[model samples]
Target: MPNNIKFVKESKSKFLTTKEYHGYGQILKISDDGIEKHIVVKPKDPVFGITIKFLETGHPQFSIPDVSIDETAIMLKNLEEAKTFCREFYERRDEFVQDAI
Candidate 1:
């Protein structure tokens, strides 16, 4: 957690279901000076997704698609190109799946 971070609650409506929900989030702490900072959070798993945190506060700014399958495929292809590259790089790789980006 950064020193200049704060959490905020937001009310949002669920699409289709038409239900309302309250979510907790954080963002960079705003100072009296009125300056805002940029915060970026990258999830470990590109396929699952990533969360972006605003620097002005610690709250989550937004979520991004992981596209892990696509990215990992590309990575695997690149690794294959290098014959000397160890195949172990992708073996038993399930543990590396990241839920956030």
Candidate 2:
């Protein structure tokens, strides 16, 4: 991931821009659920070389500490929002890692 890269929403559309680090590429997916946004990212594990990790099926963290339905998730209603969220989510945190085996 390139540092401080910018993503812009088109005047009447949306788009995604990417940057390469070492040799890994970035990917983003955005979705809507009538009331919120969902941004999902699959990044290559730096410690394991360029092996991009993935989930076989389902929300990879379905077994995390249970919470009430009031829990909040970052909502990305479109492509541009998703791209921004991906950049922030990956870069802003160190211990907040999300992974599934």
- Consecutive 10-residue window with the lowest summed lDDT within model 2: 92-101
lDDT, residue 29, model 2: 35
Tens digit per residue, CA lDDT, model 1, 1-101: 11221123322334211111111221212122123212233333344433344422323244544356657664444333221111221231121121011
Q: Flag regions of model 1 displaced more than 4 Å.
A: 1-39, 66-101
lDDT of 2 at 80: 36
User: Clashing pairs in model 2?
Assistant: 37-75, 37-76
Error of 1 at 10 (Å): 34
Q: What value does the lDDT take at residue 67 in candidate 2?
A: 33
> Which runs of model 2 end up more than 4 angstroms from their true locations?
1-24, 42-101
* CA lDDT of every candidate: 0.28, 0.31
Give me the candidate number with maximum TM-score.
2
